[model samples]
Target: MTKAPHRRGADRTEAIMRTTLELGQEIGYARLSMEGVAARAGAGKQTIYRRWSSKGALLLDSLLSLHEPALDYPDTGDVVADLRTQIHAAVDLLAGPPFGPLFTALIGEAQYDPRVAAALNERLIAPQAAKTVERLQAARDRGQLSEAFDLDLAMAILSGPLYFQLLITQEPLTHAYVDRVLDALFTGLGPISRAAGR
Candidate 1:
């Protein structure tokens, strides 16, 4: 049976997003164009342009579609352990595969493109950061963190170093490095109970 028009459009959009990721992986975002994605997806350039006004917008949507499931903050009763697990998973995403290099490219694009910057923040960064903050707030509610804990500060502290290393220094986000960051953040600023140590 023929799919309805909207359903077919949705399917085509998915295919185009998938192609964006695959092409971004292969050629990197510097060389990825809507024309290339349309050619690869067997769709018209107008089709892609109709859905996304720019390469960054298309790549942002593609990254979100691939990454949303993998990036959820886990809650396993032990906030520290759960955060460790989630951060490690995040490091894996940032260091490996279709997400990492493409994300790096997207960040680079965002530096100069205000529209992409706004969309990236609203669509991806803000949502994911909110999830991390929610997880920490839950820990506070349960007394795993102090009532005085500055969760907003902690969130910035937790993520800032990682982003710095990833985007600026281009250093490795090793597990040990992540642990040290966690230990310093938890111990010095907001002291999660030593009992909560992994």
Candidate 2:
């Protein structure tokens, strides 16, 4: 669908993005359009064009903005507990409105659009996921982890079950699931040993 003109470049772009996500939530991405976002955002067409220049770019920012900074990975001293916290954070995000359906729709769209794939990877994957990798690296360096640790495998183990429960089973990601998943993953991951009574 065609969107009306946007407000202006920077502020306009953000406004459009804000409006786009709102519209996306109200009406599924299938029905999304620049016009709807612009109208709702009170932006101008030229405003959006100046910043993004393409629907993919605009949509990318729109989707990315949903990630609040606090949602990013936390580097707690205890990796297992940290991983559990991260998993629970994901569940909390999925269980909420706009993120689950919005991200799911974006994932489906990414399959057909290479740009979307790259954008998704850059915005969502890199920041939070890379932090996990960094944490794993730290664990390895401290000799707390097995030499055979596969980072990719480790991350998958930490996150896979949660995704299975939330994405596949479409079940609620309760605290129980979080605890269970973390326990299973930690058993295989091999967290660093702690001193007694430390």
Among these predicted structures, which one has the highest TM-score?
A: 1
| Model 2: per-residue Cα lDDT over 1-198, one tens digit each | 645555334455566788777787888878887767767877777666676645656677876664553665566677777766776776666656656776666666777888877887787766767788888888777766765779877876767776677567877768787898777666766744456226
TM-scores of the models, in the order given:
0.87, 0.75
lDDT of 1 by residue, 1-198 (tens): 999999998899999999999888888888999999999999999988988989999998888875674678778998878889988888887766647887777888899889999988897688878989999999888887888778888889999999898899998877888999998887865555668766
Runs in model 1 with CA error above 4 Å?
A: 190-198
Whole-model lDDT, candidate 1? 0.85
User: What's the lDDT for all of these models?
Assistant: 0.85, 0.70
The global Cα lDDT (0 to 1) of model 2 is 0.70
Q: Which stretches of model 2 miss by more than 4 angstroms?
A: 1-8, 42-57, 191-198
